[model samples]
Target: MTTTINANSHKSLIRNKVWSRLRAVALPDSRFHHDYSSFIADFEGSSAATDLLQSLPAYQNAHLIFIAPDNCLQELRYRSLTDGKKVIVTTYGIRRGFWILDPEQIHESQWQMASVLDGMENIGRHMTLADISELPTDIALMVTGTGAINLKGLRFGKGHGYFDLEWAMLYSIGKANQRTQTIAVVHECQVLDEELRGEVWDTGCDFVVTNDKVINVKDASKPSCGILWDKLEDGMLEDIEPLKELEAIKKRSRAG
Candidate 1:
């Protein structure tokens, strides 16, 4: 059965639907066990995060981007690299706005110390800036949950739309590619086979990492521009102010 939805409505609908299912499965006393410390220990106790880190091609590159945890649970803590390498970590401020943390200023103590499972001490974490234009095009940034909302698809987030907007910005500028592999770290339980509905602005990830595995989701046929621009409706662009600001869209509408 085919389902149709407006672009603006997509975010709220998908978020509500996905979070409803996730809260049922991931909340306190759930089957998966919602203990943050235990979950971190489990991932660190085993070869999960370390193994996943080692397997990525972008890891060899110096600069990297990581996300901050929302609930003080299941977060990666990074230490300075011995080679004096720089890293960029994307963290969110209150109200779901994006901000970049400077590596040099990480010691200010304003940011809470993230609990480490293991091996996180060896890595470094720098907060990312709100402006995507400030980011280096060459660095690789990792995101959670395939960077998109999925009703039953693998690794859904807790329903905040920040990750999707960040990824969509990168894709819009043609900056997310092999050099920049967007990765998602999730539990095996969050992974699902259900096909997710995506609008033009939604972005997908390059790889997904779980406690036991890493799966690549790149589709060669889909190309870097996954969704066809022509398929986007006029009202959809108006709904997302950022899209309306893009030169391509402005030029297209003028030509039409």
Candidate 2:
């Protein structure tokens, strides 16, 4: 019998290893979420990771947060709402662009329901680039999940650039900036021992929280950039409505 490696790529191999580790755990019966096998999200100890994330001083202080729509982040979103923090989140794959989910608007009883993926669409108020630009508040934290990350603050996602684009659009509108704290939550198994090369728009995280502990990147080099309109390729403009809308907004701004 022969075993097959997924590919020659480093990130692919790391992702498969993490996936295998995640799958070995028997999911507790308490959490309600989509199957991890179906989506490139977290499993098993996601709640514990979220608990660690919520304990950080930055998380406690943040008034406005941007959370990725990963099942692993579902609990964090709920806690954010309960903590009275404003959550800026994109729908799955960012298909519907950005939305603002304010706890003040939602009844306290519904926070848990409203934080889930489907609930966010129903409860959150959709915002366009112009709408977001008009916001008086700036983002305090930008939290997400990734395929793999190393101590060098390098990160790789499941290949789609949704999280990168989310940051870019927000940065373009001045809703987010370099000073905003970024966090990547994952199971400990997902942490990489090898340093991955950084891209210009990588926007690596400042902190990596897992089920057991928090690892702060002491000398993280997070390079931030606004939307690279020229780099928009492979039908990205057509697929992501927010990017298309943002491109038009910037064009009109430049024209005026």
Candidate 3:
């Protein structure tokens, strides 16, 4: 019998190696940060944000942006709000779902504070996927995270599938399209040397910015439509309230 190395097995090996390396370097300590979370490693998130802002004019031009709420991305979120861009932030683990933040909604003094998880609750306008589905806002840019990524634009989150699910939800509601630009910020060490075998349901980023360089991914393929219900396992939606609500909304729309 011949043994075959499938995509899943290959991805698992890569993920394990990356996570191991990240753990060794990124664990919270004096060098990283006093308040570092597990998700944050040795990545210089603030430096990378400065590089992204300088290299890409999109940050300056974007009227609306969707950025993840992670320790590394806090500065980027702050800059986005400070620039007066309408920002969309996800509630941690989607417990309560998305927040649409306009700088004008919060007092000018609180914009910087609202960039983090705790402050966002008070300063941002929290909304459900159902509420956003009814709105007419367009996201010009999306900033995402990765435990590890490759030059081919393949990326995996910290085991949990929040970013992918968020993308699927937005795509399903006619929010994300071909023109939607996704960017990932990571440390130079997080960029892999080879291409990754990606699954159909796995989305790709259009650009990856590291502290050292800005990579423009060519031929990156992202999901053009909504959730891949068939790809989801049983009880997946049961664990996620936002997903359940979005599914219900999708079903009602289909029925009508």
Weakest 10 consecutive residues of candidate 2 by summed lDDT: 1-10
Residues 57-85 of candidate 3 have per-residue lDDT tens digits of: 76777788888766567778877777888
Judged by TM-score, which candidate is best?
2
Q: Which stretches of candidate 2 lie over 4 Å from their true place?
A: 1-8, 26-38
Q: TM-scores across all candidates?
A: 0.53, 0.88, 0.86
Candidate 1 lDDT, tens digit per residue, 86-191? 4433333212223343446444342334323222232323222325555665446554532222322233343334455545545555555545556655555445
Q: Higher lDDT: candidate 2 or 3? A: 2
Q: Which whole-number lDDT from 0 to 100 does residue 233 have in model 2?
A: 57
Predicted structure 2, TM vs. truth: 0.88
Q: 1-256 in candidate 2: lDDT tens per residue?
A: 1121222266666666666666665343234333343354656788899989999998999999999987678889999998899998888777778888899998888788889877877878998878888988898899998766787666767766677888888887788887888899887777878755555767778999988889999766555577777766588888887988987877898999
TM for candidate 1 is: 0.53
Let me know the TM-score candidate 3 reaches against the reference structure.
0.86
- For all candidates in order, the CA lDDT equals 0.43, 0.78, 0.73
Off by over 4 Å in 1: 5-47, 66-74, 79-97, 102-132, 135-137, 145-160, 171-179, 220-256
Ranking by TM-score, best first?
2, 3, 1
Which one wins by lDDT: 1 or 3? 3
